[model samples]
Target chain A: MADAAAAPNADQYEEQHVHEVYEQIASHFSSTRYQAWPIVKSFMQELEPGTIGLDVGCGNGKYLAVNKDVFIVGSDRSSNLVKIAAQHEPHSAIIADSLVLPHQPGRFDFAICIAVIHHLSTPQRRQEAVKVILECLRDDGRALIYVWALEQKNSRRGWDEGDDQDVMVPWVLKTGKKNPMEDGATEKTFQRYYHLYRSGELEADVNAVGGGVVDSGYEKDNWWAICCKSESFTKASG
Target chain B: MKVLTLNFLTCAVKACKSTSTSFPLHPKDCEMVSDTIEPNPKLLYNILPRVNWTALLTTVAELGFPELPPNPPTIEELQADEKMTQELHTLLLETQISEGCLVCGNCGHAYAIKEGIANFLLPNHLV
Candidate 1:
């Protein structure tokens, strides 16, 4: 993928590099993302019973089953992913874009947009994504967000600070079939666009969208933040 | 999509969010299914307060279900009445739209439902 700032057609670029890739690898991707991150699990567990929330970009809905007492409506751009997610009982999943969610504004108790905003092709789009999430929240509603960290030198990708923030990460899908012309199984590589958030970047985006970061920390290879709409923004909109 | 989920959803169009008509999208030519889900009164009681009664009434009436009371039942009333609890549990959770369209009252944009999952993705012009 090209630099985020240089992409002239951000939506089209994302439609190809982000949306289409996820549509193709939804099942394979869902199988590998079954493990729940500790912070996200704790965030879901801490919510009060009867609270309603949205899981923006809920792939496979692994988190939807974490807490049965509360209800969560999960949405994903990929129908295949939403299909897998909809199977989680006591919760629901629908095919929806995070940027244009189908829910009414300022009604949710909480929301979690994990590893989804980074798929947006530009900083503006990323912040807009955050803005949309914040808009869905009530006055006291808080949202937790996670993005791939640029400071993951210890991880396999070794994306250090100052590296190109926007890059294409390849996901290799192994089709279990003996290739007639080759010696190994058939495989396909899909390149997915990601904007690696540098240290303090996630918080900055939240603030840029008039959201206040309640708490933030680095966990695993991702930067996570819990945020709420700023008082002024909420008042102005409400 | 479950009937309860539809209560929270509206037209995905940005312009439709501000309109009163968009909330509780109207189901058209919907094929309904009733799943044998275990009844949970606590969940139903907790969820009742959040549901917009007027919109839910409109939804049920459109779906050919019997008309509900003028107002939602109090949590205490719901807790005491087993039949009401079961009925609400059935209406909100068990009942789902298997296939059809959810047309937005404001924009008249119909989102398709297939295999119990509603596609809320709008066309490029709508977005």
Candidate 2:
């Protein structure tokens, strides 16, 4: 216990804290994340039946079942989420670091990484996460990635998409046992690190991976991007 | 875990690069459980084209399962043999690695599967 807190660099600190948040919130996260976003579903539906796919940062593996046609192997950092994912697609999900996916290059036809990259606490790490997803794909393979957007005007929670890009968001859990309201008291809040992105950040990162973005737009307070490892795109961007 | 599922996996250590052959993570004292999933022969027929037949065959045998054919059946062959398709489905989807270790062939890194979950997290030194 002391060793865990003894020393951790910026990356390790973020990793450790994120893991804790997910471990605690695994069930709550799944309850809210029961359905795949429409755009992501459309993307999954477009894939050919036999196409091999990877859902990097797959939380609860909702999209893994989107297209029964594609054999999607889901991977998440949290073992809890992986367990839920495995329940559906036996042996599909694995507890893995997104920056170091344990699979071969050019192994998948396409991939879906949703609401994942925004969790990285730094820009360099954000880049590395994006790089890892692209690295997992074939040269011609495509990936649909999503990140939380700063322009959250449409958000129901009224989350302050504040001016500062890097921030910590707190999630309040309902303990189910209602304590009498002695006073206006705040529920216990769990902090989750996030690096909120502006409009062009996701696009630039995709282009930084060398003009890999086929299409990118803001939808529902999130940045949605379609990236591919096209031989020509890489050459042109490089 | 199903042998065919192992085909796409590698040791999750950060040091292990993509070029490394991550498959055949040796399962030692593997506890297998049988599960029943509705068999869809059509899906199996579609999957064979993408899978590396030999890798799966070798891994399955290594995992101590009844040996699958050396070469995967052709589309027509798979469609005709419902029993074989169901068997493949059972092996891949129903047979769960309830608890065991998947040791990497090259790295000797042991990834543990406990209670049907595979813990692919590596320690700091390994990362």
Candidate 3:
């Protein structure tokens, strides 16, 4: 009871911080996020052409641009990121929150929520994001989701060396970072909310949300998992 | 937007806002261009399984490229004829919808596509 009273609404905190951090860093974020992680590229490349794809939290639309053979609809909460993504993605890129996706249920055979879920502040909210992602997929569809793992090699990976799972990670915007839209404007440092996953935490939370984790493992410093809407859950939803 | 992507896109209007009713939005007054690329018959053959044949056929016809066979090619037929597979490659990947409006079958919302960008933005009243 004390814990409940002490904690601010997790989703609301995430909603406020995530948007602010991204909006401020949208320009700098796009410049560095040029290449798709090799794992992500391989996953999309394997899909057949004409597959219906959705890139949830599609920051700067890297997946949409690289995997041109399949038509992918892109979405992001930040309007600035969506606009930048629209420049590369040849189709629809809309402003949408990850919690409430824009498309109908079962509309996508292929979906990816990459580098997005770790931004959610609370455990329950993270699980809900995973559930919402699965709901976006058809019963036969597949999803690839990645979150930052607690096991980074260098300095303590998540937060200042402690038992706390939730922490705010800061992004340092180098002074005089090349401004894309305008010339010679410097950017400032910013901190973003993150809930770093520890090993099976991702798979467990997803499973709790009725999402079936087909494959899960650590890739580099991230906990990556592939999921699908299970048959039983599909029938129940139907 | 590619014609194949149109297979998935549908009217996002308020009324037909579900998997059952909103899908395969009609591409009305769409202008398109077809590009040529190296023929990858294997890729084309693999793509055969996922194409929503009826939706694609109707959508492509509406886009003024009524060249696809009335019936989709069987897997065996596609594997046997590389040229047919290559043609399908052109249809699915190369064709681009540069300008037009996608009309919703359920609620009469026309999503405009200008310079290859589909505007899914809804008016304030709709929101």
Candidate 4:
């Protein structure tokens, strides 16, 4: 908490830890993320055939292939990931930041932000990211957001309630070749900042962003919420 | 980026959000390609309503494509006319912007496009 509070250059911090790391390990990370989560699959499959939506923080564009009928514009901070995502025909991918998406406000039919908010090293930045996602939706449009959970004692990480939420998770990159002239494989570990949401913390952030949570639940060691723009926020802003 | 995607994008700068000229970013020195995308009339009919026709017109004209009708054809009209469906498909889904820079009228910020992906990452000063 003390270290996170001192992060005056949160953008620069994320640039080093989050953005740069993804740029380096995009292909390796994408190889491990091909399968879409069950809840996310169902949520996307349920959309109307002609619906238009966004996949914010869309790594490798895995979800872009989920449903071919709908058009999805996938965006990622890493250009390497966007390059892979652009291969999903009929849908498009572009390099963009979630906090400052190039999309128009309240125009999209729907949006999905999966496993993205946790990377923000600060609570205020997390809520600000949520606010931007909400701002992209139409009055009746909905956005599904997912984040890492603190209460995942059963998982490999073994984190649970009452633990420090702000933590650095390690991503190990194994590189080398199996050749007579070369040495054995070497490993490099990169630390990524994550803010694990405890119990109702995700809902609280949504409410703080003036978004209404329609449905929320825990799935596979992560917390997920489906939300929409609040009527009051719309009325107040308009 | 597809011409369809350009229709939905604008300047990422926060100050440009409220400006009227921000939507429909103007493409400069664009290298375009047309892939033979399988036609989907149902998708086009559904997408037609949500699209900003005026903004799309601006993008099409800026890219040097033949002028489209002033207004978007209704879904009924699109469905009945196969040629219109093919034309719309060619314009929206097939045409790709492989290389270019999109300039914002609001802030004069130019976002570079390469390998069919547009980079919207603003410089630190701009951010």
* C-alpha TM-scores of all predictions: 0.95, 0.89, 0.73, 0.95
Residue B116, candidate 4: C-alpha displacement in angstroms: 0.8
Q: Candidate 3: TM of chain A? A: 0.86
Please give, for residues A86-158, the per-residue lDDT of candidate 4 as tens digits. 8997899999999999988988878999999899888888999999999988887888999999999999999
* Residues A1-238, model 1: lDDT tens digits: 4676787888888889989998888888888988889999999998877789999999889999898888899999998899999999899999999889998888898999999999998888999999999998888898999999999999999989879888989999876775322556478888888989999999999998789888899999999998988835433321
Number of the top-ranking candidate, with lDDT as the measure: 1
Worst 10 residues of 4 chain B by lDDT: B34-43
RMSD (CA, Å), candidate 4 to true, equals 2.8
lDDT, model 4: 0.88
Least accurate 10 contiguous residues by lDDT in model 3 chain A: A1-10
Clashes of each: 0, 1, 0, 1
Q: DockQ of each model against the real complex?
A: 0.82, 0.61, 0.20, 0.86
- In model 4, the Cα lDDT at residue A147 comes to 96
Whole-model Cα lDDT of every candidate shown, in order:
0.89, 0.75, 0.72, 0.88
lDDT of 4 by residue, B6-122 (tens): 888999999998899998899999999888888888788998888999999989888888999999899888878999899999999999989889999999999999888999999
Residue A19, candidate 1: Cα error in Å is 1.2
- Candidate 1: tens digits of C-alpha lDDT, residues B1-127: 8999988999999999999989889999999998887766667788888888999999999999988999999998987888988888999999999999999888899999999999988888898
Query: Residue A23, candidate 4: how far off, in angstroms?
Result: 0.9
* lDDT of each residue in A49-156, candidate 3, tens digit only: 656778889889888766655657787877778778866533446666676654667867779899998887666778888887787787878889998877775645
Error of 1 at A133 (Å): 0.8
Q: How close is candidate 4 to the true structure, as a TM-score?
A: 0.95
Q: How does residue B112 of candidate 2 score in lDDT? A: 87
